[model samples]
Target: MAGYSLERLNFLVVDDNKHMRALVKTILHALGSKSVVEAADGADAFKELRHFPADIIICDWNMSPLDGLDFVRLVRTGKDSPNPFAAIIMLTGHTEMHRVVEARDAGVHEFLAKPISAKALYSRIRAIIERPRPFIRTATYFGPDRRRRQIEYKGRERRKTVKQEQVVDQSSVGLSQAEVEALLSG
Candidate 1:
């Protein structure tokens, strides 16, 4: 929070609870973010995204008409997606391993458990800005790479190399490398 400013970033907060939305907005505003949009549900979020071009999306897990998982899927793979590469942070009270796996599988970039704190929120945003994951395109997945580690691979590659393309370009959605380094070092 001390090193970087969120003023250059645009954010979208999607949640079914009005209070929750307000709380998140307060946190974002306090962090120097002036461009924060709110959506009551995933459907509304999509509508807002069509015009907002959010740099990061903070969304809740449960909502009517469209849940967070479905929304993430659409944002990642839908033909009409406004910004498939936008970083997503899923906020939910469900801390179960299965729920986390489900959210990860649906293309969420970060998962934040509920009872949210400004510190936790800021940390998640920092992680996104500091280490943006490359997008991976496959027959079934077209979102950020699910892998989080760099363990050495001892086994031969099983999948065909042609079928997977790693998208490493982040110029359009985030700050340049120089900008990020300056912020982190400041």
Candidate 2:
């Protein structure tokens, strides 16, 4: 139900391929996302993040300018944390074991293989949003506009920052516990 509501999220789709970026924006719109922003690559994504951080990011992995893994790391460890602590879903053509492992290590919340299917995209989006995990564990998690006025009006407020890195379970991507067991059994 979380992802089923259009009123819930503002999304960002980052991919080097123009068509793919457009396609993702279209899909998110269809899914009822309030606003969808597109970025050509990770650099453009960083600019967008600075201006208005998105609730979710669906990015392509093999980009000419700043790959998806670097983007994920940047989001996870950046000084000025991006809004909503974007739930990142990496889009990749390669499903090679090493590539998948590398992506997981780099902090991607979900994976959507290339030639994106609607079902897969919806599944991943819902998985990330509907999960019980806390979205962000920081005090200063709101947008700059909102926080700026608050800072100006309320001089100083105690901010709680968590040092621990969020590690999402691999099984949460799309595979159910039983499905993982079955895959392992085979």
> Which 10-residue window of candidate 2 scores lowest in summed lDDT?
142-151
RMSD each, Å: 7.7, 11.0
Stretches of model 2 off by over 4 angstroms after superposition: 1-3, 134-186
lDDT of 2 by residue, 1-186 (tens): 332675667788889989998888887777777788888888789889887758878889877568887877778767765653577888887666567667766666677777787777888777766663444334433211111111233555444343346533333334555424432342
Angstrom error of the Cα, residue 25, model 2: value is: 1.2
- Clashes (N, CA, C under 3 Å) per candidate: 0, 1
Model 2 CA lDDT for position 115: 75
Model 2 clash tally, residue pairs = 1
Model 1 spans > 4 angstroms off? 159-186
* Winning model by lDDT: 1
My TM-score estimates for the predictions, one after another, are: 0.84, 0.70
Pick the TM-score winner: 1
Residue 113 shift from truth in candidate 2, angstroms: 0.8
**Per-residue lDDT over 1-186 for candidate 1, one digit per residue giving the tens place of the 0 to 100 score:** 348989989999999999999999999999999999999999999999999989999999999999998999989888999999999999988766677778888898887777889998998899898888877778778777776655456788654563434535444343345433433342
